[model samples]
Target: MVMSANERLFYHVLIRILFVAVIAGSLISLLAEQFWVAELFTHFRLYYLLLQALLVLIFLHTGRHTLMALTILFAMPNAWVAGPYLIPVYGGQRATAKAATSIDIVALNVNYRNDGFARVAGYLRERDPDIIVIAEYTPAWRDELEFLRKSHPYQFGEVRPDPWGLAVFSRLPFMESELIDLADTDTVHARFVFAAGMMSLEVFAVHLLPPKSAVWARNRNLQLENLVDQLGASTHQRIVIGDLNLTPFSPYFSRFIERTGLQDARRVDGFHVTWPVSVFPVWIPIDHALADPEVNITSVHAGPDVGSDHFPLEIRVSKGVNKQPGQVRAVFE
Candidate 1:
């Protein structure tokens, strides 16, 4: 079917508007550190590039070579920024001592108000991860989790009515457990002296206030900075996972990595969005997992949805060597 003159004009106008908006957003978000609204736009760098690529294809099909050229030029900046998070990590030689182990860690945000305990619980049993971290834990959920005691016998956390409540259930025994108060958020911290053949491993579960306004944005930044300070003084082989409420595109996230020397576990093949679960196409990865540079994050992925607005995250770690190859491995296991 052929479009009338007005119909063709309308389609052209709509595409032009979308292209302009995408270009503007890509540039304005660079100042996200100075303003909260800018920070909100910063999280969508990957999405922006995706939209730009689609726009470029449309331009080429419509024989608009100039628009196609400009679109590619603007998309380069976003690609440069979001490139690291989307690509796979460098596959380097890994230590293969006899004590090496592969451990699966899971993180889930069981929305406190969600009445889908059975769904989330069932998902856990199906995955059977060695360690689990939960956000928005509650007294009611605590009782409900009793069924998991047989598999994940060790438990420690703060159960509350608020969304900030956090919990950790593990098959491995905890050497030490504590609750840290950072920027009005109670962060759940857990330690495993010798998990499998790996030596000490410490995990910190953090949830920051959504940065919808200036005050909330500042608080989130403060929480991250304080957490970094604490991490600097903590033991090695550290892992931090939770609903960070900020994406990797944010300057603050870059600072967190720079200051603490932690690597994002999102070194995957493509975008792995984990929030705003819905029928809409808009989605982002606000929930994240980070680890020390030395730890090998074999894979990080989204788990089955558990009746929440966020999908659970499963991270698999491969420590230096085979689990039972060395005498040290046998002694620890």
Candidate 2:
């Protein structure tokens, strides 16, 4: 069929718009960890739905091929929508064991200037988690958290200045603890050994640097990548718990998953938002608990507010082969 000039122009314009959107999406993914951009996209994901509706209006009026292309291309947000609660794509490994015994592990990034240490300590004691990690812990916060040592004997972490200190408290005696110092200032990674099934297992607690600028984002990505590589080589049934400050949808987070072969705590459930507790609707899943493929994740959730800008995350895991090879069975089902 002979195409009119306007029709030809429409096809060319549509292809160009799709190309640009693809590029823009890639850029956004790279910048997902930046606070300003992350906040924008968090709200954008909601408004983009409305934007899609507007696209339909434009489609009806113009019947432009470019609008059609852009409309279809907007499906990229599905990843963001489903990204928070995606199930682990653990290929081949099936977690066979149920949570015969469960341990509540909590990860919290207590804002440095938080004055609610008493409330935070009370909240932690009330939950009685088997393990707890707090980042952005200042000297005062550490002093306040020290009271929990009676219940949790095994402690490993260092108190630092404003934005980067980390601490871990556990019921199990820590057989080992060392700050990984991953060539980055904001992170404090450590391995804690615990007894399980006549063998010792190690849990690594980490708080990665927040990716703000392009340079910072790339640096954060590299630091996490290196950490994952080291952990992947470790011979422990690993449970990595902490406020990573990165979300599941971010490319860096995705790379961390691919590099470590670890499963997200919420993969089988829903996205648990944990930040800006002072601001209602300021929700994003920055805190994380990731486990090795060998570990069986039972449950993952966000805890009650402890007066920190970020809420705590609790994840329960055990060791057992899955019911079927390469199948993810619901913990309850």
Choose the strongest candidate by TM-score. Answer: 1
Error of 2 at 136 (Å): 1.7
Q: Write the residue-wise lDDT of candidate 2 on 1-333 in tens digits.
A: 999999989986885575455445544644555544553354334334344555556666777767556665664564455434533433223333335465567888888988888888888878777788888878999888777778888787888877778888888776677777765655667777776544556777877777666666566667777777667567666677776766665556676776666677676446567766865564777777777555666677777877888888877655443333243312210
Candidate whose lDDT is highest: 1
Model 1: per-residue Cα lDDT over 1-333, one tens digit each: 999999999998999899999999988887787788998998899889989989989999989999899999989978887866555535422323222367788888888888888988899888888888888888888888887778888887788897878888888787877777776545444333335455666777877778888988888888988888778777656778889998888889888877777777676434578897788977888988887766666678777778998999888777663233212100111
Q: Root-mean-square deviation of each candidate, in angstroms?
A: 5.9, 8.6
TM-score of every model versus the real structure: 0.87, 0.74
Worst 10 residues of 1 by lDDT: 324-333
Give lDDT for model 2: 0.67
C-alpha lDDT values of all predictions: 0.78, 0.67
RMSD of 1: 5.9
Clashing pairs in 2: 14-66, 94-322, 95-321, 95-322, 96-320, 96-321, 96-322, 97-320
